[model samples]
Structure formats: C-alpha cells, structure tokens
Target chain A: MSVTYLEAIREAQTKLLREDERVFIYGQDIAGKFGGAFKATKGLAEKFPGRVLNTPISEDAMIGTAIGAALEGMRPIVEMQFADFSSIALNQILNNAGTHYYRTNVPVPITVRLPSGGTKGSGPFHSQSMEGLYSHYPGVVVMTPATVEDAYTMLIDAVAIDDPVVYCEHKYLYYHLKADALPKESFPVGKARIVRPGRDLTIVTYSAMVHEALAVAGELQRDGFEIEVVDLRTVKPLDTQTVLASVARTGRLLAVGEAFPWGGVTAEVISRVTTEGFQLLDAAPARINAKDTPIPYHPNLWSEHRPNRKSIATKARQILQE
Target chain B: MLQTAQRGKKSKKTAPEKPASKKGQVHERYVEAFRWMLTARILEDKLASLYRGGMIVGGVYLGRGQEAVSAACGIFLKKGDVFGPLIRDQAGRSAFGEPLLDVVRTYLGSVKGPMRGRDGNIHRGRPRENELAMISHLGAMIPVMVGKLLAKRMKGEKEFVGLTTLGEGGMQTGASHEGLNIAAVEQVPLVVVVTNNHWAYSTPNEREFACANLVDRAIGYGYEGHKIDGTDLNQCLEVIETAVKRARAGRPPQLVVAEVLRLAGHGEHDDASYVPQEMKAQPFAQDPVARTEKYILENGLLDEDKLKQMRAEIAKQVDEAVATAQQEDPPYPREEDWRSMSTDELIDKPSF
Candidate 1:
C-alpha cells in the first residue's frame, strides 16, 4: 500500500512518540478525534494518551510553552494551524527560542510544524510559505520536505535536532504527493537531493515547487535540453555545495520557489550561487517566485500568482539559452 | 530621621509581638525576604551609580519601589519550581536563589556570568535550575513558566509550581492573555504576579488598559485572583505566599495583582520627568525598601541594630561582586565562539 505525504508526517510523530517519552504533540484542535486542521495528527491523541495535548488558540503561547518545555528537557512539537498564523509567534520563535542557546547555552529542542504553501483557494492568510521568513533568524532550522520519504524522515530528524526547527509541510502536497512505501532511510537534513540529474541547466527548488521544477524538467526533456533539479530539503542550512556542483555541471541555474519573490528562498539561492559560484556559472543565475502581491483566493489568480511548471519551464528555457 | 521617628511612634502605639514559636518562623521568613529586598536595592543602587559614572554599558532597570512584591514572588518558590523574572525583578531573582555574582558579572560584561556576557543586566538566568532568562518582550515569560510546569507534570514530578512576574503594562498584552488562558486550560500549577506600578514605561494606567483593576482579568482567564499593597511587605508576603500555596495545591492558576508605583524611571537612561509631582506624593510611591525596614522594626521582626548590620553586610557583598566582575575581562570578539545553534553539524562554516 502507498503512503501519502500527510500520512508520513503522522507516521513520523507515531514513531517519535513510541520511541521517546520526552516527545509530546501540542497544538490547537489536534487531540481526541478532532485530530488536526488537516488531520495530520489523526488518531495520535488516542495512541499516545496524555502525550498528545490540545492547546488554546494561542500561537505565541504555543511556541513560548514549547521553548519552556524544551528548556526542561522535553521535546515538544507545536503545530501552527496555518503558516500565516505563525507571524503572531515570531517574537517567541525568533527571540525566545532562537536566541536562548546563544545567550544562555540552553538549546530549545522544539519543532514547529507549519502547514505551508498554497492550496487552490486558500487566499492570502491561509496560503503562505514561511521558510524564508523563519530562516532569516539564527538558531532555527527551516525544513521544507517535498516528498513522502523526506517528510517522514526529516520530521523525525527535526525533533532530534537540538535547535528550534520550522518544519514547513506543504498543504498542497498533503495528498497530491505519494510514495510506494515509507523509505527505511533518507538523506539527513541540511543536505539537498538531486531529484532529476542532467547537464544543460539546473532548476533548484524545494517543497511543492520542487515537483513543479521536476515537471518543467520533463517538459524541457522533449526538446534538445537536459535539466537538473535539486530539491533543497532544508532552506536555512542550504546545501550550497550541491547547488554549486550542479551549477558547475550544468553551467546554468534557475531557482524557483512558491514563496513571494521578495528576498525569499528563491532569492537566497540565487544570491548564494552568484556570490559563491561566480566562476562556475556559464550564464547569469535566474529565479522564479510568486508575485510580490498577496496570494489571491481565486483559483485562476492563485495559479498565476505562484510559480508553476509552465512558468518554471519558460524561465528555465531563457536561462538555458543564455 | 523624621520619617523614622514618626514610624517609631506608630510602632510604640501598636503592641510589639513577642517572638512565639510560630511567630518566630514568620519572623525568620520576613527577615529572609527583607534581606533579599535589601540586597537587590543595594545592588541596583550601585548599578545606577556605575551607569551614571560611565562604568557600565546597556540599560540599568531598578526595582526601587516594587521590591516587596518582587521579593515575595520569588521567596515562596522551592528548588524544583520555576521562576521567570522580568526587567524590574532583581529582588525576586535574589530571593529565587540567583547569585549576586551572576547579576554583577552580566552588568559588567564579564564572560563568567550565567549569560556568558552574551546578554547583560536583568536578562540573566540559569535555566537548568528553573530560572528563565527573560527576553525584553513583556508577558512572554508567563507562557514559558506554564510550559515548564507542564513539562514537570508530564515527567510525573509533583508539588512544584512555576511563578513569573509582569508589570501592569504587560497585563494588557496578548501574550499575557494567551499564556494565562492556556495555563488555566491545562491546569498547570502556575502563579503570575502582576505588579501594577501605575506606569508602563511612561504610559499611565489610563493609556495602558481600561480595566478597573488588573485583578479583574484573572476571572476571565479562569485564574484565582488576589490583590496586595505592593509597598507593604506584610501584605505582599501574605498574599503572594497564599497564592503560591493555592497553586501548589493544584488550584487553578493564581493571578496576584500588587498595586505599587515605579519610583525610578523605566531605565537609568530615562530621567522620568514625565511623572507628575502629585503622583510621586501617592502612598504607592513609598519606597518598598524603607517600608520593609520600618515594618521589620514595627513588628519587631528584627531590631534596628541587626537591620543596620544586614544593610552593611549587603552593601559590602555588592561592592565585592562589582569589583570582581569589573576585574574580569569582557568577551573578546576574536575569542568569541559566536555559534548560536547547539548542533555542531547544522552550523554553517564561516565563508571568510
């Protein structure tokens, strides 16, 4: 039987709860049959007993409490119902959890699961990719898993991480992505994976956008071009070496992301490649992201707002020709 | 001297209690709380002077008027219990068992402090010992304290409570509302002490909140509410100790609102000329340090000679801590490790 990306997340939590007594899930509407907003925590409350708890609709307190629990040697997983709402808890996440170890030598081992990326009509508030926002802060590890295997393993690795981690699980990838079975092992976090390897051009992306890049690679393959797709599993400790090596082989780079175009993961990737791998580049690095405006509600506008396979192929074609 | 004479006359009119066995315990507790208050007062006074003399960097926030309430918040907490002290909580920090050296070293930027010279002044705490180093955000520590208690509860630890202090201004923050509500919902043994010092920085109560009293918020948050005269040591000690006991007894989270006035400016950098002279004449503006000293003398908890000796000893301790901290080297940029993340593998190597 196949496991969906969402089930892989639930399975990771199940494994963590079974193995470590220190592991506990705390979030709003995530306990006792309610499961979660997306049902990512379906049946976890019953299985773990008191290990899974429902919290008040308090994002600030959710993260603050997680930090406190982490300080006391408990690994807490806080689920923000949506990535947009995490803005309310940014102070607690960036200042409290992010700065704790630097100032006091106390590592806060808390994983904040953000249901990120845009669904068809999620609108501005519900549809947002916050990896770049969280990655801007120090002491936080930002993970964006694009596959079922990475979703399961990286979540388990996120909880094992000593520093605070923002695990951005794309809402769109919940059921759309599937795998034959959960993998026994996967690449560790902070390492990028080359989903499709080629030599003509490199398309670097993560999360839901990685699939879009892969689709673009397929579309371009019908032509004379061969494209390389590198999935950046973790955005913060970006696998610059893999990206640079891919760029060194392909000589062209196109960074695509679902987040806004303004200084996000796409921009960060292109900046790093241009700065560190200037000699490796045969053409100027390019990137494609969502429009600078807020994510729209209409499915047609939303489709156009975010980078898709068509837009990624168009951008990739231009970079390859250069 | 005139104020002391008037207080002495008032003490004479009231019957001085002989130290019975039960009263002796109460007296000892009062004296212990007073010692913390006194030490905090002396240390902050030195810090203010050093700041004025340009010997210290960063802001110096003094708990000049709110010592009674601050000290009471920490004094009742045991070893296993957690304490989250705010900017004006040096008195509480001391009573909660934080070292004077930690305070002095942080202020002087010595690398030997609890913060390792990364954070300075009131932001110092030993989290391993359940003392949370507070960030500048007000009301943020409330949720942290709740989480600490929740973790302890999950670990099957019992009889421990977590206490944190916030200002009247912090009571209106969304963090306070959310944290307090969550604590109540989870039934965590947490006590949140709000010291209504009449002003949040320069903003008065009228500008900060519309509630008649901050204690009214406790009801909405499902907390057992109590109020105290923060300048009065007897009331502060009695009310806070009771609130803490109720919380430890597994009662709903306690919210103790103490009424006082911030006698000093928000920080040493602020002159506080914004405070009207009429407000300064108010009873809540009375210095908790002097009031506690008078209460000790009035109740015969300790004699004038012993109080004098305690003050001298505390002053000497403060002086030595400051000297030792000043003699130690500040963190050198070249020698600083500067790694924020604890995971060595996750940390990115410096490109330069």
Candidate 2:
C-alpha cells in the first residue's frame, strides 16, 4: 500500500506512542472522535486512548503546558491547528521552551507540529510557513520534511531530541505526496538530500518547494540543462557544507522556499553560499521566496503569493544563464 | 461557583494548639513561615544593597508585604507538587526547599549555579525537582503549571498537584484567562495564587482592573474564588491549606486572590513614590512578618532571646552565602563544547 505524507505522519506518531510510554499528543480537538483539524491525528487518538488529549482553544497554554510536561520528562507532541495560529503561543515556544535547555541544561523534549504552507484560500492567518522564524531561536530544531518518508522519520527523530523542535509540515503535500511503503531507514537529522543531480545549476529547497524545484529541474532537462536539487530536511542546523559542495559542482545556486521573502531559509542558503563558497560561484547565488506581502485569501492571489514551479523554473533559468 | 466576598478577619494574636515535629506542627509551621518571610525580606534587602553597590547585575524584586501569601502557599504544598515562583515568591521558594545559598548563588549569577550564569535574579528554577522558575511573561506560567500537573496525573501519579503565582496585572492577560479555563475543563489539580499586590510595576490596582472582585472571576470558570487579606498570616495559611486539600481531591482549579501590598518599588530601582499614601499605609502597618512576630511574642510561642538569635543566624547565613557566591566564576561554555552541551547528539562531521 502506498503511504501518503499525512498517513506517514500518523504512522510515525503511532510508532512513537507505541514505543515510548511517555509519548503523548496534545492539541485542540485531537481527542477520540474529533481527530484533528487536518486529520493528521485521526485514528491514533482512538488507538492511544488516554495518551491523546483534546485541549481548550488556548494555543498559548497548549505550548506552555507542553514545555512544562517536557521539563517533567514527558515527550509531548503539540499540534498547532494552523502554522499561523502558532504565533499565539510564540512567547512560550520561543522564550520558555527555546531557552530552557541552554539556561538550565534540562532538556525540553517537546515537538510542535505546525501544518505550514499555503493551501488554496487558507489565507494569511492559516497558510504561513514559520520555519525561518523558529530556526532563528537557539535551542529549537526546525525540521521541514519534504517527502513521505522524511515526514515519518523526522517526526520520530524530533520526539527523541532533547531540545524543542518545530516540525513544519506543509499542508499542500498532505495527500499530494506519496511513496511505496514507509522506509525503515532514512537520512539523519539536519542533513540535506540531493534529490536530483546535474552539473549546470543547484536548486536548494525544502518542504513543498522541494517538489517544485524538482519539477523545474525536470522541465529544464528537455533543453539540455542539468539542474541539481537539494532538500534541506532541517532548517536550524542547516546543511551548509552539502549546499556549498553542490555550489562547487554546479557553479550556480538558486535557493527556493514557500515562506516570505524576508530573512528566510532561502536567504540563509544564499548568504552561506556567497560567504563560504564565493569562489565556487560562476555567478552570484540567487533565491526565490513568497512575495513580501501577507498571504492573500483569494485563490489566484494566494497562488501568486508563494513560489511555484513556473516562478522557480524562471529563477533557475536566469541563474543558469548568468 | 461560590462568590462571597469575605475580607479576612483583622490580625489578632491567637495561641493555637502546638503540635509535635520541628516543621510540621501548627506553631512550628508558623514560626518557620515567619523565618522564611524574614529571610526573604533580609535576602532581598541584601540583594538591593548589592545592586546599588555594583556587586550584582540585573534587578532585585522583593516580596516585602506578600510574604504571608507565598509562605502559606509554599508550606501547604505537599511533596511532588510543582510550583512556578513569581518575583514576589522568595519566601515560597524557601518553603519549597530551595536553599538560601542556592538562591544567593542564583542572584550572584555564579558559574556553578542552577542557571549556570545564563540567567540572573528571579528567573531561576530547578525543574527536575519540580520547583519551576518564573519567566518574565507573568501570566504565561499558569498553563505551564497546569501542564506539569496534567503530566503527573498521566504518568499515574493521580495525587500530584501544581501551583503558580502571578500578580493581579497578569490576570488581565489572555494567558491567565486561557490557563484557568483549560485547567477547569481538564479538571487538573492546580491552584493559582494571584498575589494582588496592588501594582503591576508602576500601574496600581485601580488602573489594572475594573472587576467587582478579582477572585470572583474564578466563578466564571466554574470554580470557587477565595479572597483573603494577605497581610493576615494566619488567615492566608488557613485559606491556602484548604485550597491544597480541595485540589488534591481532584477538584477544578481554584483562584486565591490575596490582597497584599508591595512595600518596595517594583524593583530596587523605583522609589514607589507613585503609590498613594493612604493605600500604602494600611498594608504596611499590617506587615505579615510583624504580625507573625507579634503573635509569637504576645502568645509566648518563642522567647525574645531565641527570636533575636534566630534573626542573627539568618543574617549571618545570608552574608556568607553572598560572599561565597561572589567568589565563584560566571559560567562561560566554550565554543568547542557548545554542540555537546546544547543538543542531544553531536552531529557526525557533515558529509560533503
């Protein structure tokens, strides 16, 4: 049976809950019958009865409690209904949990699952991808899983880590992305995977944008252009060496992400490439991100809001020509 | 949702039945509470001097008049209960078993301290032992306390309880409202003590709230709210003990709004000239420590010589702890060791 990205997330949580007595899921409407807002925690709550709890509509409290539970030795997986709504709990997630381990050496083994990226008219409030915002914090590990297997594995890994983790799961790839069975082994945390290899230009991306980059690479193959793709599984401990090495091979780089065009992961990728791998670049390293505006609510405007295969391909072709 | 507005009886000297044990008996607990209150007062006074003398960094927030509330809550809390201490809770921290020397070291920002020089002043706690440190965001800790209690219950310790302290000002925030509501809905064993110390930094109680009674808000969350005269040590202790008993029995969350005064400025920095004269006069006159001392002296609970000796010993201990802490080096984790110290696993050298 083919395992969809969303199903793989459920399976990973199931495995973690089954294996560790301390693993529990806490979020809004994630209890027995309601499952979750996105069904990411559907049947698992029924399977692990008492472990999965339905919380009140208090994101701030949900995260704070998760930090408290983590401090008390329970590995809590807190699900934010939407990535945008996660901002309500930013105080707890950023200051309390993020600074806990560094200040006290007491690990806060908590994972906040933020269903990220734009999905049709999910609007500015529900469609934000905050990987960059979370990654900026010191004690937090920000994971942006692109594939079905990575989604499953990275989540399990997030629970095992002592520091707080922001698992930014893209909403658009919930069912669109699939694979033949979940893999038993996968890439280690913080390592970028080169999904496709070429000698002309390296396309560095993660989450939903990784697929777009791959598609762009495929389209460029017809024109005798070879484009390499690197999927950054985690954003905080960014895989700078592999990215630099990719830049070295291709002599051109284009970083892409669905987040805003501010000081995001894409900017970080290009910044590191230009700073450390300056000589390797045949041209200046470039990046394409969502427009510097609030994620629009209209379908057409929202579609135009984030990076797509068309925009990515155009950006890649420009960088290759340079 | 019982919502009676019961002002605590006026502070009067009463000799209750003294029990056995050095710290568990009624009179003993009262004596210890007074000592803790004095210690917190004296300790903050020293810290304030240190800050002024350039021996300490960051600010010093004193518990001054709210000692009875903190001591009562701390003493009533049983073993295994997690407590989130506020700036005005040094007495509670002491009653919860945090040593004076450790507290001094934390204030001094010593390298060997619990925070390892990462933080200073009141933002220090021993989470592994269930004594949570306060974050600067005041109301945010209530839910965290609820979370700890919920986790304890989930782990099969059904009897465990969680407690936290916040000012009346923090009650106005969304976090405090959400935390109490969730605690009620989840039926967690948690008690939130609102030390309504009449000011939120420079803002006073008049400017902060318009509610008829602060404690009455608990009724809206489907729980009884108790308003106690915080300066009355005996009343504060009795009310907190009752709340603890109710929480341990799996009741909904309870709010104990204790009306107290902040004798010192918000920190050692402010002169508190903004406080209205009459409002400050009443609570200052009813200082918890003085009330406890009067009861002890009038009721013949402890002799004058022993009380005087106890004060001298406490003063000496504080001086020594400060000296020892001052000598210790501040924590400075080397860059090479950052990986091992911060993360769970040192990454294998990244494959190029």
Q: Which candidate is the best by lDDT?
A: 1
Worst 10 residues of 2 chain B by lDDT: B10-19
> Who wins the TM-score comparison?
1
lDDT of 2 by residue, B244-326 (tens): 76678766676888988888899988899988889857753368888888889997789999899988998998999898988
The residue-level lDDT of candidate 2 at A263 comes to 95
Q: Which sections of candidate 1 miss by over 4 Å?
A: B1-21, B350-352
The DockQ assigned to candidate 1 is 0.76
Q: B1-352, model 1: which lDDT tens digit per residue? A: 0000111222222221232337678888888999999988999999999999998898899998989899998999998999999988999999999989999999989998888789988888999999999998887888898889899999999999989988988878899888888888888988888899988899999999888887877767767778788998878887788778877977777788888989899999998889999988898889888988888888888888998899899999999999899999899999998798999878854253
Give every collision pair in model 1. none
DockQ of each: 0.76, 0.53
Where does candidate 1 chain A have its weakest 10-residue lDDT segment?
A264-273
Count of steric clashes across candidates, in order = 0, 0
Candidate-wise lDDT, in order: 0.89, 0.84
lDDT for each residue of candidate 2 in A96-165, tens digit (9 for 90 to 100): 8877877777878899999999999788898999999987667788999999999999999999888888
How high a TM-score does candidate 2 get?
A: 0.95
Candidate 2, clashing residue pairs? none
